[model samples]
Target: MKVQVKSFFSVLSGGKPVVRTLDLQEGTTAEDAMKLMKVDFSDGAIILINGRPSNEKSVLSEGDFFVVMPPVSAA
Candidate 1:
């Protein structure tokens, strides 16, 4: 299965949005994919799957768009 991952305002790309493709096995969870990419969940990023709000435990499917973005601040 292939999953498209996008990280916005993330450490992975020096706070820039970076899109990448991950070739994973069937039954890969969103958290698992993040781990593969070395995402730091401790930074408190919002997880979105195909633009829908999701969590780390969310299961991933083929052609799924897994997005990680830092929480927006008023400042």
Candidate 2:
């Protein structure tokens, strides 16, 4: 199964977009994909599965879309 992963930051920063397509086996967890992408969840990153908040261990299915966002703060 193939999943689309998208990472976006605020538009004000004008940073490069982070996006990738990953091929994973059935029963792959969100944590597994994160590891494959070398993303550390502990860095205040939030994961959403199909537009809903999901935990690292949440199981993923075919055509799953993951949106990862960094923590927001007020300066």
Candidate 3:
């Protein structure tokens, strides 16, 4: 199964799209995908799977899209 991953910051930068297609086996979780990317999300970061808030253990499926965003604040 192939899953799509994207980062919010990359989209804001207008840089090369952060979207990536990965071939994962069955029963892969969000944490598993993060590990594959070697990303250690900060405590203040928010994770969304297919537009809904999700956690590390959330399971993923083919064609699933994830968006990772850091907490934003205003002074």
Candidate 4:
């Protein structure tokens, strides 16, 4: 299955966020995908599937869009 994964670390990053197309297993979960993508969401992140709220365990589908938005803070 092919899924699109995107992460927004901070708006101040000047739109350098990463968007990747992952060719994952059929039953791959959102969390697993993040790990495979090497995203540092250890502190926590707002996860969404196709623009809707989702959890780590959510099973992904073909052509699904997964987004990871971490809490923004003043650096």
Candidate 5:
């Protein structure tokens, strides 16, 4: 299965394009996906699956779109 990954922080891909494609198993969890992208989950990043907030344990399906970003802050 294929998933689309959109990252909001450079840490996901060393400041490269925020979008990338990942090929994973059907039952792959969000954490697994992040790992595939070489993203560090310990950063307290926020993840959203199909525009809905989700956790690392959440399982992802084929063609699902997920966004990863660092926690937002106000100045």
Candidate 6:
């Protein structure tokens, strides 16, 4: 399966917004995907799969668009 990953606010490996494509096997979990992308989960992040709220245990399907973003807070 092909998964598209987008990371915002330096939540991903490079510490910068990035768009990447990762090919994963069937039934890959969101958390596993995040780990593969090197995301920092300590601060708590939001997962959106196909524009809907998703959790780490959510299973992905082919051609899924997944986004990992830092938690939003108003100052």
Highest lDDT model number: 6
Give residue 49's error in model 4 in angstroms. 0.4
Compute the lDDT of residue 63 as modeled in candidate 5: 88
lDDT of 5 by residue, 18-75 (tens): 7888889879999998888777778578999999999999999988999988876789
Model 6 Cα shift for residue 70 (angstroms): 0.5
Candidate 6 residue pairs that clash: none
What is the Cα-based TM-score of model 5? 0.83
Candidates 2 and 5 compared by TM-score, better number: 5
Q: Best candidate per TM-score, number?
A: 6
Clashing pairs in 5: none
Per-residue lDDT of 1-75 in model 1, one digit per residue for the tens?
989999774654656777899999998998898888777877567999999999988999999999987766786
Error of 4 at 4 (Å): 0.6
| Collision count for each candidate, in order | 0, 0, 0, 0, 0, 0
Instruction: Give the candidates in order of TM-score, highest first.
Output: 6, 5, 4, 1, 2, 3
Listed in order, each prediction's TM-score against the native is: 0.82, 0.78, 0.74, 0.82, 0.83, 0.84
Q: Which 10 consecutive residues of model 3 have the lowest summed lDDT?
A: 8-17
* Candidate 2 residue-wise lDDT, 1-75, digit = tens: 999988764332676657899999999998888878766667666889999998888898999999777766789
lDDT of each: 0.85, 0.81, 0.77, 0.86, 0.85, 0.87
Q: Which of 1 and 2 is ahead in TM-score?
A: 1
lDDT of 4 by residue, 1-75 (tens): 999998776443676778899999999999999898776766778899999999888999999999988866799
* Clashing residue pairs in candidate 1 (N, C-alpha, C atoms within 3 angstroms): none
